[model samples]
Target: MLPPFRPGTHLVFFALLLTLPSQALAVIDRDALDTAVVDAGELSRTHTLLVAVEGETVIDRGWRGHATDETANIKSLSKTLISALVGLAIERDIIEGVDQPVVELLGDRVPSDIDPQVNDITVGHLLSMQSGLQRTSGSNYAGWVASPNWVEDALTRPMVGEPGERMRYSTGNSHLLSAALTEASGRSTLALMRDWLGEPLGITIPAWTRDPQGIYFGGNEMGLTPQALLRIAELYRQQGKHDGEQLLTAEWIERSWAPRTRSVFNQDLYGYGWFRTELDDTTVHYGWGYGGQLLFVVPERNMTIVMTSDPTPPSNGSAYLEQVKAVVERMIAATVP
Candidate 1:
């Protein structure tokens, strides 16, 4: 038989145990995070770094006097925004599913003499960068943008491979998506973005560069604040829900994250507009822009990180990109238990 003794003795012991340090009570180390931010500050090109874990921002630091709220050109990171718009467009039924042929929407823009294969390109092909069209990003960027009709030029470019055959990173593919969205919705891409995302996410959607046809540049030169970018990342991290509303469908989020092709440059898996790769043994999905504008989502950690860098030319090539990724890896390590 157990004796009913004084309860104070047991209660005192339990209280003492609660005060003792335990791994179960461990929280993110702020000092380690501060050190990581210090290291990021040393990168000359990096302007801002914002880190959020579990939907709460822990660090928002700006380097070289840059403010986190300042808008900067996100470069190819705009592709991710375009992808989101496409997803939202589909959800609204303005555009059909990904399988719909893009030419169905842009048929008016297709050149008369273009190859018949152009008709085979679908919305999914453009989102995954598997449109098989000649790239309009690197050396051809100058000439492509200089053309009188950006959409027509992109559609008329020679097919380098079969549609949906392989990933061929091209801004033109993204621009074509913008045009299709415009035609299907009977609204400018900017209007769709402002109504569907900007207003819902409560982020400013500044007007960006427009083509000669007055279409907003799709995959490049979209200006967004780092804080705004973080909110966008969080939206995806939350599987397209925001403020108790399903702004984007969970199905669309899953489809956007599903690996559709491989990037030849870095060997990273390309989904709709995000790139998947391993960092510090953790799977990371990121949106990379020219000159190091980066948005990373670590689903395993419930983390979303944004880094904005100088958009000037001479990107220092992949070497600098690796360095920026290392900075992110360090931040992730700092959060480990």
Candidate 2:
């Protein structure tokens, strides 16, 4: 026959087991976050930083008056938005295909000097930053922006290499894309963004800095709130869906995340507008701009991280990736559900 249970023994055993492995992982370490906040306070990062995991609030601290709700220029990160817009355009039949020769669409806007190489460049080449056109921005940025016509100025650059033979990170290619979109839709790039993305996502473009030509600066200089950025990351995570609506086709997102270029710094493969890195054997895709602006999305971990700052000495994208990965590892340790 079984013996009768001891009065308090069952209760103690259950309590011990509850704390062992069945309990949910803590979402974050408040103390560790406090240290991060303190560190942010001491430095002059361009703006606020926000981190989120699995829809759980992990770190939402702001320093130097930066907050989650505030928006700042995301710089070259805007290129990704432009890329997504192209994907949406493809889905909506705004254009026939990525392989379409861009010169035929630009009409009178095509360059007067018109290198034969331009004929060889395709929409895909531009999107992939392998257009082979001399980069429009550089040590020459000041001069380029000083021009009254950004599109024309960008087109005038020399073709230093054969099209598709090399990868060059150029704002010129993206600006040309904006012009291409303008010509294709008979609507401004900004208008197209509003009709397709901004409205659907409920995200008003916070602000977009423009060039002398008054076109939205390509490849750089756009502003967005932390939540707004999250919405973008989430959009990609869901393969271009927004709030249950299919804004961009799953195929486009797949292509965009697919490797088209390699990271300029570390040989990490780059997609249409995002960088893919292997962290702890898991693939991580992210976006980084000139300053310290970073947006990381880890599908496997169901995690997203965004950091913005005009660091005193410029933020290193790779190092920041490691920092975020470490913190996310801890957060995963304590994740609930």
Candidate 3:
């Protein structure tokens, strides 16, 4: 059985927190770095790790039984993927805008028995995780599905705060976005992603779990290869273009990174569907998930790092992100003209 988690069913994280060098560390020796991470505690038992420099694969390693094309469930990294699709839907006029009141969008789904402030929430609020809805992930998830319509059940939640008043990291918000996208486009999110990202980028979609309501589960599990995650990051880095064509609006990419929430920790910020941060002044936007699953896209340095893991506690994960950031820092130190 899976271990316990804190708020939001965090899926947990555990990374070897490294002490920063009194002096900057050296450059990218792909082989040396891979060996180092693999040697670090249980992180060494990680299923997969992929690193890319510019658009080229620099390091690729797998556990005893894995491969380049093999897709693994990315867990919550899919939230960021869902965020990009929301932008594309807006670009296509699939919906009026993210600010549209969600209750009107979903029709009868809002429980007739629930509070009316549910109607006041907007699509943007949902995407940014400011929805004021009860987090529907974790142990609450089972009770969620046991009911008839999971998506509707989530929307029925009363406003915990004025819309956009506070930051509450809830996966339910993204599932609502997926349902909204389905309603707006008249197609499933999976099909839309297949057409927009998978086919265009020559990528694959691994296994995905769906609710009885037909909405994709937002956080827990969505499969993807590390290379696929890198492509998704590369697409964002290139401002949502692929092979010379614009797949996502440049303004959306720019707007998506506009920090809307401040992190309790240093070196991080939250935008619409993206996370923003800097390491030594170089900007890195990334998606972090339970157990350290992530795609760290560093545009200024033209690097991307992908990590997937089994859930670990916060005491262990506290330095995990910083350690990954250190990898980029050391690699950046390696590059000098």
Candidate 4:
């Protein structure tokens, strides 16, 4: 005979069941991903490649003597983490909202005689790389880093266009967000990161670079182990929840995945911290870093993927990224119908 239901018993049962580790929603054709890695020769340059389906890691491997557990510089992928922190800050009331004016946040830090256009920039502008400030990336990168104060240098740059007008793709914009987070929360970005994400996701976040002002560098040079990267991607794939904990609001995830602009370099749609595109009939939201550090989330398939490459070599517009995409394509196709 079956046990009779009791008041709240079903709820308790469901809660207990939810604590069990997640299982794959669908099987992946492991051989396909394996063959793709070999055929593409990604092993030579790629340090690690990982794939997770339905919150369970199915494939974890490293190449060229690099261990999958080794922390690798994620480059511009740091932008994605910074963007996530921005969402958490808003949720925690650290800042008002994405519409909060940049100048309002930075009061006295505003550079002397800064272009008036800077006042109109918002947190959203920085998140989407549409701050209208001349980019501090590319050829401007060395000079920007050479400056004594990263935030002040970024603010002092002349506005090339009005805020929210176009995607400028600058590390300067991310650095400013990092600075804002520090000022608004009265905590180092690294501290907030550990408390907000690293603790929740059970991932280690080691300290990265900081500006001359001691603010953690926001958009560049952050490091994470490939396994940790997979967990982060899985967090987004699950709509900002992990093991029944809502780290980020589903609404914010939707907003982050929604395309607000387009990347000039690749023409891919840009959301808050993710790049969006449809590959092989499956939508992909991704974080890309220099030298081929990549994290991809395919929500429709309940899958997350990470690829780490040599951070020292140049990969901008290089064949390496294309090969990374090819690997993704293979993984996407491996999804069981």
Residue by residue across 3-94, what tens digits does model 3's lDDT show? Answer: 45456541222222122333222135444454555552235325667766655666677765765467776666788888888888787878
Residue 242 in model 4: lDDT: 86
Q: Against the true structure, whose lDDT is highest?
A: 1
lDDT by residue for model 4 over 90-174, one digit each (tens)? 9999899999997787767777788888988999999998999999999999999999988989999989998999899999999
- Quality of model 1 by C-alpha lDDT: 0.86
TM-score for all models, in order of appearance: 0.91, 0.82, 0.82, 0.91
| Candidate 2, 59-93: lDDT as tens digits | 67666677778877787788888888888877778
In the range 1-337, model 1's lDDT, one tens digit per residue, is 2234454432111111221264122245566677778988898798999998767788898887788999989999999999999998888888888999998988577778777999899999999999989999889999999999999999989999999898999999999999999888888999999999999999999999999989989899999999999999999988888876889987987888889999888788999998998887898899999989999998877789999999998888567888888878888876652
Candidate 4 off by > 4 Å: 1-25, 40-44, 316-318
Q: Better model by TM-score, 3 or 4?
A: 4
Instruction: Name the Cα RMSD for model 1.
Output: 7.1
Q: What is the lDDT, from 0 to 100, of the residue 50 in candidate 4?
A: 85
lDDT values for all models: 0.86, 0.71, 0.70, 0.84
In angstroms, give how far residue 20 of model 2 lies from its true place: 29
Worst 10 residues of 4 by lDDT: 9-18
- Model 2, stretches more than 4 Å misplaced? 1-46, 311-337
Clashing pairs in 4: none
